[model samples]
Target chain A: MKLEMRDQPGQLVAALQPISAVGGNIIAVIHQRETPAATETLDVQIVLELPEGRLSRLLELLREQGVSVVRIDEERLLYECTLIMIGHLMHTDLSDTVDRIDMTGSAEVTELSLVMPAISSPSSARITIRSTTREEMKKAIRILRSVAEQKDLLIIEPLEGA
Target chain B: MRIAILGFGSVGRGIARAILAKNLDITVTGLADSRSGIIDPAGIDLEAALSRKDNGGPCGSLDVTPADVVAKADYDVLVEVTPTNVDDGEPALGHIRGALRRGKHVVTSNKGPIALAYPELRDLAATNGVFLRYEATVCGAIPLIHAMKEGLAGNTISRLYGVFNGTCNYILTRMAEDGLTYEQALAEARELGYAEADPTYDVEGIDAGIKLVILANTVLDMRTTLDDVERTGITLLTPEALRLAEDQDCTIRLIGEIVPEAGVLRVSPRIIAKSHPLVVEGTLNAVTVETDLAGDLTFIGKGAGSVETASAVIGDLLYIRDRHVQGS
Candidate 1:
């Protein structure tokens, strides 16, 4: 995982805490002091092996400690999220909805099914999204919600830990 | 690492032997030819397979095709070495597409598939999150693609020129040295086993054109096809042309040149100074890539052979292995 943190004292130590707390094993840490390209903060790249489902908790812990994650390798993400969008999907451009998810390299909508009650009525789509981690899936769901909000529609996201 | 060999020709056999001789942790889980296929999750016995095929056995069965092995085999990669069909890159292109779509990395020597459908295939591989490597597709054993793409990754390539087709190079060399006409040079090439019985593809510049298209797309980040290359075969040049070049301290080589700034891509019999990097003699392939950071880089080696091309296949296999290991 790549992270950006304020170049403050103990920030690196603070970042390491959540990883170990979530049953993660650190493999390497590339903490170069110089600012990376087009970024104001310090770049800390961590290679780690964590258990199957603790990545979300790790991200939460890091967020609580005020460490900003810049990127995560696709291998580290291992979670699935299936979302259902309700209302005027075709009118609002379903392509945009799917494109928003597919464009994100971290997540992909692998399966999608649509149901339309009538020609005039709105459609409901069941979109199955797979990501490398739970946080990435949530980020996609957030994008879906924003798209739904802009189009004056309703989004029924997957249940917690489903 | 599990590997599936989609073609059982010389290249396929060479890679199988290299894997065994090198004692890599790779296993041939699936093997197939144009007519049939066989699969074993544990591994296919290379020696037995070779002997069986050598004895005129089908190797597997006519019912199970190469596509079936690619789809059903317990393998991480698909090594595509089938005969090239420049007309449309069928069978080979379909095999590569199926493998990439199934989240399997592809390593191929069949130039037609790459030459014709590179952009689509490249996007498919990226979307499916797998690699598509074709080092043996151009300049068989010279490592030109890897050298330009990875070794000189930092530099911006400006132009490229080279003798890409060994058969054509051999014919041209004979024409220049022995002062033979086109027919005589071609006959010599066939006698020396440098060319196929029907050498139209090599002698007519289509083979070099395909290789040039592959290079243009892969390394130069240009999207061009076999049709886009302004091609002129070496058959048109005469011994007088060769002698004229020699008098000017130059030699005529079947050269493929690409000047990206001018948007120029062509393959023809061009006269270059004898001192030029592309002026290699005999059945050797050479490519000179002009780069901003690394200056002029020239790569020369045997462009085609059973084992030499197999060396490139091994390199690609290990490349996929290392990337897989690192990613996983």
Candidate 2:
């Protein structure tokens, strides 16, 4: 996010404090003091990672701090879960399984590693799914589970918080 | 305290051995196997019964039956260590009901009667002014039911889950440790007496599912049965699936979980981090109970074995003897 605030000593600190308050981690801050001295506004660019649904609160906090947000670039998908699916992966239309998750719009199959041993034996694959929120991740898993059931596949999900 | 024991299987024999080895001040007045039974107002000779069972013979005379011991035995407590019949929880169920009606305290390691008819049996026990304790039904030596009922009585339990089946745990542990296929590991388990010849009950997640139903219905105040559980077994799990979990420092174990708030009872192969407390190795069972006041408590112990299960039964027996029994 790029911020425009008054050219003051404490304005930079004021802009950065709201990031931590909203439980965000500031990755890098690109601030240049060599802006032309004609205008009283200073431009500072910040790279941050905020938890899902905190971006709006962060913007409100920044506005309260008398800071103007020029531009915001968002990374929507922040939650990732990995699961292993075992069955005849190739025979069961694996691409269709991946397509079902991608069709949810809020979650997508990001990475997959497949191992097919032989022609007649069952195969295994590890699927990594990224979702915009935890709830969406759960929904994605539900869809995958239904698909696995239709295909007679085994899905092993992570135990934590499931 | 005088007690009558039914079922001369491994669990019943283990309890007899413990009583004989220790001066627990308890007398067994009646004993029975499936075919025979013995009843004496004075204590029965447990040493003789043990030798008789070991020699491929009925523990007592063939004419005497288990129902006779339940009805006519002179005992304050009836120990029902019979095998579980999940369909109707019969014989054990009938035996427990008879003991409770006679105003006798009941201690059982059988999952059938408790899981299938906990509420009815509980009300009967309360009406008759007796205690119904089943500590060895779920995890063998963990004393989970006792802890939840006695030690953590006031706390509200929200979630309870764990590795409930030792046979599945042993298979998964071997699969991850030695890179054995599911069939090979299960074969090895059968050879080592960890699994039965027909391992369907254990490997298909029904065993874990039944245990979950027992916990949910008995402790969590949830009305559920084996059919209510969402189950998935490890039979279809490939070695590659385990390897995939291994790449991320995780392994798959059959986990049985219950969330009372969400009305969830699930048994499936779940990927767990190696560092997690519930990730017990081999035939060990681990359970974590999340409560409102006391936070989370995890219990790990030997889930199954002759003496281990006997330990849980003895704990329940002594608990009854201390609080309810008139004299030792």
Candidate 3:
């Protein structure tokens, strides 16, 4: 279930609690806070398996909790990889790096987190990208490396099978 | 597939005709009307029964009763087109409970039973592993129910509002377009068989309110009753009030709305601009479902008619058939 929830405390928890209450097995959850379209609503893509014909009930539960589900992508993603980039991430235009990978239409950086340890020091981010196939994921990693190298950012390569 | 129809009214007869005319692969094993009932486990001859009823005769030969259809008929699905009784949802509600308890799929065009006991029947159907469908309950021929349930599958509907009652819409349209008073337009509607002799049900917004309750419960998963809807009908509207709306490029429409975020459901006569989708002309049902992904989708179609409603009923039947086929 892909949901668009208001970016606030407990919104993501409110969205996931219904899935759990409905006995859904949470396979993966890709919550990208920065990719929300226009509205500041957080974009949540969740993968889970439940009893057939239970999606509608879960959706209603989300609605009852004031969370707006944007879509339910039934297709399952087969390959996922998490990478960490360490450098002046914001100065290098992070959105451009994510957009280039997402524009490929097969792979997307569905989750991202940024942390700045000090005021003037470099900022690092962890990005989890997924695609329909392992080959597509490799292409995305290549794109990420190329983009990071061009921006003079150091890439801590993804751990094998991590 | 063997089926039993619990009502032999115009809507029921229309469904029979559609089943035959469309060459659907199903058999009517039993049919019961207000006055008489028919039963034939080997499949009833629909043409002969229809002809007999048309000639002012009992639907079946002397022996059968409605109770026999509910109890003895050997069928898989029960189609209930019985008269709506909103107060208690009796008879229809009783028949529906019987069918579901017997592990039979039930399809109904009655609104009262649904408006009153939707959650109960839904749980009953789920527990029994049978389907209970009521597409024709709200806006007949509009395919509104299926659109909300299946067509708009993944969309998270934020707000849903629409013009559901054709009788009210017709009266308002005639009054606005032809400069007629409410009573004058209502008489015209009665002449056209749109309004009943006791038009309280249509004019006082009860009909639309009942439908709003059904939609809120079924589509939005809100366990609401007809009483939960704050209803205000069109009997109080005057030509001057309409003219005042027209001066502002608006028209009066009976709108049933549900704001899920606010946890509110209401049916009232409101002034909407002529350009609005709900500003449909004469006896049409229009609904808009606002969603996060699909944006807003507007659907408009005939709200009443034997054949039109039969379309919705048979559509539900075919959906059940296809789902079972795929399941197996």
lDDT tens readout by residue for model 3, A63-144: 9999987777755666777655667778889999999999999899888877665667666566778886677888988898
lDDT of 2: 0.93
Q: Over the stretch B1-328, how does candidate 2's per-residue lDDT look in tens digits? A: 9999999998999999999999899899999999999999889999999999999999999989999999999999999998888889989999999999999999999999998999999999999999999999999999998899878999999999899999999999999998999999999999999999899999998989989998898888999989999999889988888898899899999999999999999999998998899999999999999999999999999988888999999999999998889964
Q: What is the per-residue lDDT of model 3 for residues B1-328, given as tens digits with 9 covering 90 to 100?
A: 7889988887998998888798788889889987788888788989888899899898875677777798889888889998789899988998999989998899999998899999899999999999999999989998888888888888888988888899999999998898797889999999998988999998888998888889888998787887788777777566655654565576678888888877788787765678887789989999888998889999999988889999988888888888762321
Candidate 3 chain B: worst 10 consecutive residues by lDDT?
B239-248
Candidate 2: regions farther than 4 A off? A2-8, A17-76
Residue-level lDDT of model 1, residues B237-302, one tens digit each, is 556556655664766788888888777788876656678877888899998888999999889999
What docking class should model 1 receive?
Answer: incorrect
lDDT of 2 by residue, A4-116 (tens): 99999999999999999989999899998787668899999998888768999999999999999999986757789999999988999999999999999999999999989
Point out the higher-scoring one by lDDT: 2 or 3.
2
Query: For each candidate, what is the lDDT?
Result: 0.83, 0.93, 0.83
User: Which candidate leads the pack in lDDT?
Assistant: 2
Sorted by lDDT (best first), the order is 2, 1, 3
How well is each residue in A1-162 modelled by candidate 1, as lDDT tens digits? 998887778889999999999999899999887555556567899999897778999999999988888998866445776555557889889888889988998888888777665788656566678886777787888888788779966554321232
Interface RMSD of each: 31.5, 0.7, 28.5
